[model samples]
Target: MTPDDDELTFGVEEEFFLVDAAGELVPRGPEVVDGTTERDGELQRELISSQVETATPVCRTSAALLDGLTSLRDDLARGAAARGLRLLASGTPVLPGSGHEITRKPRYHRMAEQFGAIARSSATCGCHVHVGVADRETAVRVSNHTRAWLPVLLAITANSPIDGGTVTGYRSWRHVLWSRWPSAGPPPMFVSLEHYENSVAAMLRSGAMMDRAMLYWDVRLSDKQPTLEFRIGDVAASAEEATLAAVLIRGLVRLALRDVAADRAPVSTPDEVLRANLWRAARDGLGGSCLHPESGELVPIWTVVDELVANLREPLGASGDLDFALDVLSRLRSTGGGADRQLAAYRRRERLTDVVDEQCV
Candidate 1:
């Protein structure tokens, strides 16, 4: 049986960069990962030596999710500090780094060998929120329903404005860098479960991806769990920002499940337009405009955010996250989201280290 909206469990996976006090990316991910105990969630190594990842335990309530993320972040921060390093949650590195080093894992080594430069330069960090679903078929259908909102979510959590010691002029430079992979970016509007599987098979056969695990669409069915994973947003600047993204994603998934149950067709946004909207979101973040998901008309980014909250009001309320979500949204509005805050810090001191310092927490 399908679970009730309030009963749908979700988990968040966040990737972080390890940097020295001067904000330079450092190859200390292994030390930090080994030192940090996974009390609330698992700590894992990433493709690059300077990055580590955390996955929260499945949580059924917004409060529980917040607590799990907060605890995990605290633990990871302490571990980094113990080794004279700091944990940074930004999507891209703020200051210049020595170079990328592929993790010693065999799978990571194989990826670097096969994909060459694409795999070598891909050290971007992102936040993935997995919302429980009944099955893979349901996950596929829900992905179609959830794809249109990805651009808005990306704009909300844009934190990687600086890259290689200079502002990239794009809000989410990580997204642009991440898109270089053949399997990355927004997933197509799948017609059915079979269609999704066939597409994956074709990509593997054509060498576009090495395996099913490389289906790095912004939204996809999880291969390791029974959930629909939303992989659009950056690793947010704080636990609260990360929690806000997870809550909003859960709301989106809940609403999609309702639409599926009602036999409502998912929005069939044109592929070209969807990709363009994503680029716009990455370029402007929340300070500029985005194309309305349905209307295709350019509107202030906050207008799209308002529409998103309005559409998810019932589901968010059913899941007991409406008030908390609203409060976070209000705070984001006042502080101007992650990218805005990062830019503000840089502009104040004209130092990328200041940007790094402000986000160290």
Candidate 2:
């Protein structure tokens, strides 16, 4: 790895759905990314016939991250309008059944053939936040301590409360849906990178996993990228919300690394409660209190969030990122998460699509 690879960095990838006029999901990929379809090539890539992915190049600062996201979404939206398509954000669109496969790429084809129905019907969108580390050791340390706090992050970014036209009664039904795969779910916190790699290697050897990416843990080190990728967080409605979650994650990592260096203990929850809290965060987001991922006690979600924000302030202050960190938390608390916005929109329009539409815009 080069010197550039040694520094910590952050980036994000988001997936979105393609819909057409009359509020219906459309399977139009060949026409979308071919450049002949009049679609903005910047933010849009044909994930399937009816889906696209938006990504921000690696960014070290909030302003740069925000710039990438803004350019991607805004340009994509304008392009969607020109093509008479509407962009919708949700883990999965509320529509039912069979979709199109416009991308004929071999990898996507193989994945579709392997997963079958769920793969073909998948309409999920998500915000994948990637944070860089010095090496595998730091990645493992960060990943281990990050386990207890994954639910907290999930709770705050629970934007996909609706799925298949219903509430789905989960903050991120996308997690539930994705977990069906043989290789997806939370990861165990190993004490070291060697342990982490060994565990994954064992799983791969068992024929249960296709590769490291298939591990599907809420937190995992990317095989392709030298970053600890946070696979939690429902894709947020606005770029601002995503920016908040991304920065907050960086703060947690920086703090966690400091603690680990000082011989502080790792935070881990019991498996049972961890599972339960994951469900609660999925079901309630911040509106309902989340069971403590570690202690199994009921904690007001926002209060816990506030305290976490406080806990990291010192280390973050030392780095001069405390202000942005606190500002993001304040916005999340005051403006509400994706779930909060969805419910509020539903109340106003008495419909879920309206909520989703508002989110994509």
Candidate 3:
């Protein structure tokens, strides 16, 4: 694609866990992924004996995304249901004392040894949104711009508010769990592709990452693709919610691209302010203030959200998903964001089973 390409494409990768009807975690049996042949006798990317992942083919527009994701999710659910398996989308382990067996593959085993104890204990699932970028400059701008919005995505999609089968008193405990890796936290602003590459090279040199793809920033250029990938969101409970996220990412990329075209800097803010708002968002979600990315002031999250929607109003309207985006916001507002729902489930039923059940539902 040329640098001026306006065509925005998308790919979604959802990591999931295989659960039972009784809402319990089942350790994936050995050769789980290898044995996961389709009923017709071929495996799509939906492999793993117990756990599985689904990737929608790269799509040209948001409308195509809805069709693709809905089809993939529905088919995967149907196939799993027929096999007496329940699929749950979340980050981190939800069942206490459940042993999450890592797939015994050379690559996975290598990752386990490379990341050490956290990798051994890590059972985190994330919803990665891949938005195609035309070049490195736009990719860098998108990465930096997307970094400031990371907390928003995290807050909204924080499905695993309770971690390790226990209430963590925060909405997205997976952030903390995911942060346990040495190089895994968030990213500083990368002003250019050279900067991002240098950081990744440094990480590799320091034994922090095996490769560039392991730079676990909220957003970054995919070493393997021509896209800026957002990896901050928890795997959502449903396809509708997942599409909402993808819509926002697509809009965000358009906005960033415009900013770069005009030589406009990202609405700048301090590192500490970003971190503070991030922690606050992790604790309270959309209900509290998100520090102004440029001002470092405690601004209401909804206020920021409204401003973002306004900035992308034209693109969002053009995509014809404005109504769906508004509906998603309404759901978050009325029923609560992920953290709110998780906490409420625990409070009403006094059990983590209720929380996990909500996850599978």
Candidate 4:
């Protein structure tokens, strides 16, 4: 990929649940990942043995991102099949076993030791998008501005309606589960990069988390990279959906940076209100209402979604992702997103296995 001053690059990381031929969750992450290394560090183990994660290479455009994601999914599927398992991209496993097996990594063991049952119950998968920036200050500034829009992002990508063999009554049950962690959720606006770093350091000093990497806010500056990462989305049901989420997030970052450069103050929503907005989004998805950050009035989720896209229109067009964003948003509005489709499947067949199987394809 050639450099373009106007264009910012991004990457996607997706986590998947591994299941057997019978559509039962399988603790086979180690078995499947023991000798596999197509993307080396990009493909990694998660806390739970039933989960595997794959990261796309840095992509300069939406098309490149879609291509990389497609290849990664196919490669992972093929590898899992050879190991007598199937990879399901849904956020929560439909038939997760009651007992959990922790991966034998030191960090994972420590997490299990600390969080116990909560750690064991986390069989959720998600899509994390990282947008590259010029420097840490820019990343921090962009992240601060992006917080208000995160609920809309969650509503659009909600896919975890069912968990542990029962419907959780929340479109993004994964979000609900992850929120139990003290550090997870929308972060507070940072006054500066120093302030952000200091806040994380304080958390670390308090043993809230083992390290900076554990600061799992909905949007955060990357601890190890010069990028802003969005961790609000579930692992999308398809490669196209994943690509769409990544592009919109990159658009958000680009637009936020532009606002920052203009010396504009970011629109702020109080943390209490933001948390409530997140819960509403997770509960209803596009089927419900979302709080408009500006008005603080509840509006149709579709209206909020469209407004978000409109807000990023200029930046998206500048980054060559406007068309893709519009197309995906249109499709989502028309056919509904993963949670809608998953619920439809369950409603049609009245079976959780059917829902899981539908997502596997």
lDDT of 2 by residue, 1-361 (tens): 2222223478888777777765567776445544432222245555467777777888877877877887777766666777998777777675544455636777667767766776675667778898887587878887777778777888887877766667777777877777676666677868788898898888889866765656777788888888889888777777877887888888778777777777787877765667777877777787778876556689888867877788877656654566876777677678777777777888897775677567766
Q: List the residue pairs that clash in candidate 2.
A: 49-102, 91-124, 94-165, 171-282
Model 3 alpha-carbon miss at residue 45, Å: 7.6
For model 3, which pairs clash? 32-49
Clashes of 1: 0
Q: Write the per-residue lDDT of candidate 4 for residues 45-146, one digit (tens) a residue.
A: 889998889988888888888988888788788889888888898899888564258988999899888877888888889999998885887777787788
Stretches of candidate 4 exceeding 4 Å from the true structure = 1-4, 37-41
Q: Kindly report which residue stretches of model 1 are placed more than 4 angstroms away from their true locations once superposed.
A: 1-3
Ranking by TM-score: 1, 4, 3, 2
lDDT head-to-head 1 vs 4, winner: 1
Supply the TM-score for candidate 3.
Answer: 0.90
Residue 336's lDDT within candidate 2 is 77
68-142: candidate 3 lDDT, tens digit per residue: 777766656566666676667767556676646666567666778777777777776778899888587768876
Best by TM-score: 1
* lDDT (C-alpha) at residue 237 in model 2: 78
How well does candidate 3 score on lDDT at residue 170? 72
Best model number under lDDT: 1
Local distance difference test scores for all models:
0.90, 0.73, 0.72, 0.85
TM-score of each: 0.98, 0.89, 0.90, 0.96
